[model samples]
Target: MSATPDATSAAPDGGFTTVIGPRRSLLAIDLAELWRYRDLVLLLTRRDIVTVYAQTVLGPLWVVLQPLITTFTFALVFGKAAGLAPPGMPGPLFYMSGLVPWFFFSSQVTKTSRTLTGGAHVMTKVYFPRLVMPISTTLSNGFTFLVQLAALAVMVAGYVLAGGLAWSPGPQLLGLPLLVLLMGALGLGTGILISAATTKYRDLSFLVGFGVQLLMYASPVILPLSRLQKFPTLLRVFELNPMTAVIEAFRAMLFGGAVPWGGLTYSAAVTAVMLLVGVMTFNKVERSFADIV
Candidate 1:
């Protein structure tokens, strides 16, 4: 981030110059500095969303198709053969709820993980806030998530017309924005943490692809949180996953149920800690990224 001169520190020529340099404070972020670079953030975010499918045949259609395909696959494997979905709830609706949020989170971690290593050329040439890289990626993913979420909303509406099945909008829907913030925060925190590490440990860049897949099961994506009850030990482990509550709350908001206040409270705390630690570590490493990456 760049440092601003005080109001009285103008040069004798009466010109104010902002100095671009390394971040000095380990735990404190310069929100004003970050705000000044908001244009760059918006640019990078646009690039992130556009470049992903720029040359692909389907382009943005894949955004809708990917979730639908995965939802049905899970519906077949987990809901039908395994008999996992709660009775009377449509399998597509059940899994789509989880996939919408989970996809946002996983994409954040995957793309932001390469902020330094994959973007070393630009990083070396530029003098913007290092934090800008990850924030743009998170924002771009959030935009894509909104597209997917609209599709999910249509599915929920369809299911409601067919049987209602407690799938109607209510005041609970208001909490959705909070859940989106939590989801983005978790992804941003974890993403930057990995992005910083990947600067020195190049292997993590490759491992992140496999790691997110494994982490999906560790959360309640394919399997509902309730089914884990038989394995009390495993259930305890899954309970600690912050996304469980976020995803569950997301479903409850659409399907009508009580909020998972306990899990969401725990999730907010964990996300706060992870984001703080992630930002501090990222800031501490900013000066060395060019050389190390």
Candidate 2:
């Protein structure tokens, strides 16, 4: 008489398995699970960076070139034509300073907003934390941001050496890392919030691009806050935009401008609330994303 085969060992797949289920807690974020899946996060991030420029002639150079071209275009339209550059700061330098942080924030927001729909295939097949998708996209784009920032630093250094610009970083520059973190938090929070919504309402995905474009104008991107002083109401409204403080802090850090402590504090508070709301919404929606996506 032959022995019966073990039921559990019948299948050939042998690796460890993770059984995912519904989260019990309403505000559960599962940071521990995310940490446990750090390898997967790194893998996904590498894939995002590689696939973004795969088979392209320029490859990663586009990371630096895209911002360079944008800064030049802004210098022409807003600087030469509209004369919107902040006094004493060169147009290209001023624009590049703002564009570096804005590019990172905008790219992360756009990519994270599509995480659920974009990764539906993997989500259906695997049992990893869904939060990894957006987190990895944010991490991958962060690498691109560093590349662009390095190029900006080089240009800024050249301008200083040529006497076209001056350098006077203060104690506020030490807070640059915190400022970057705030920028990422704002983008991730907003993106994940939108991502959860878009899983049900597909049209919301189409609006992300337009919304981000409008947001850029609402912030102090092309024109400095100083230029809008005549319009106190408009400036106050702009201050309400979280990005406005981040951009202002970026400029202040790099160019010896006045740091807006009040605005930054407001932005930080708003960012914390947004992130909490995003995590809750994402947790509630992630359970059914595979079915609808």
Candidate 3:
């Protein structure tokens, strides 16, 4: 008689044996799987974009209004009252430039940080890669951010036409892509970290909202790094925020000014480290998510 086949043996239909082993520390993110779910990502992203503007009469106009209003307020408070120099450019242009990226960064963080909870039903019921949730959130906000950025460009043109602005191209312009990457990396990394933590701790949601407001004040959205001259120590601390480099780099690129190479490099380094840590932690916790979350 033929020897009995073992449990590990392959089935006649071509199915392979399954084995349970220790979970790997780093999940080998399957790009192919993500590609297969690209439609889902796009669908979810579209949902977010639509829901964000659904009830508002102005709809997507809110994107343009948000930064426009904030920039105007900052221009009045910081530029007019504080007598800030406006980053060697016109006051409105300077304030709006920083507001654009600052809003993008903050919005990305807030939106993505809640991805897991916001889509908990989908997460618990679905088998797709969990990373897709936060990523889709980022992409959704990114689309709106681009729209707002176009409005910023039109405003810049208006400033130029009125002789209130002067601009030139600089090498820093080439660094805008890198700046955007760092911003996304920083937001994604922190968002995942917070989202995972918040799954177990409910209070984190409130903290995330409060923290974002404080973070905006901490960043140089309204005030330029140059204005921090009197507080050299504070300036140094701000430089360490990672976003400091991103906002400053954005200003430099748009205004044709000197690049903040030191700060930018620091941001890149921090982003790399944080992303690695956040991904690892996220993956490790992902398995038990359905159970706990």
Among the numbered candidates, top lDDT falls to 2
Sort the predicted structures by TM-score, highest score first.
Answer: 1, 2, 3
Tens digit of lDDT per residue, candidate 3, span 79-176?
88877756567777777887888778788777777867777887788677788888888898788878978998999889788888775767667877
Ranking by lDDT: 2, 1, 3
TM accuracy, model 3: 0.90
In the range 216-244, model 1's lDDT, one tens digit per residue, is 89887777777777899888888888888
Per-residue lDDT for 150-224 in model 2, tens only? 999999999989998769889888888889889998899989999999999999998998889788988888888
Candidate 2, residue 153: the lDDT equals 94
Candidate 3: stretches off by over 4 Å:
1-14, 17-22, 85-87
Q: What does the lDDT read for residue 75 in candidate 3? A: 80
C-alpha lDDT of all candidate models, in order = 0.85, 0.86, 0.79
Provide the lowest-lDDT 10-residue window in model 3.
Answer: 1-10
- Give the C-alpha lDDT of model 3: 0.79
Query: How displaced is residue 287 in candidate 3, in Å?
Result: 1.0
* Candidate 2 residue spans exceeding 4 A from truth: 1-23
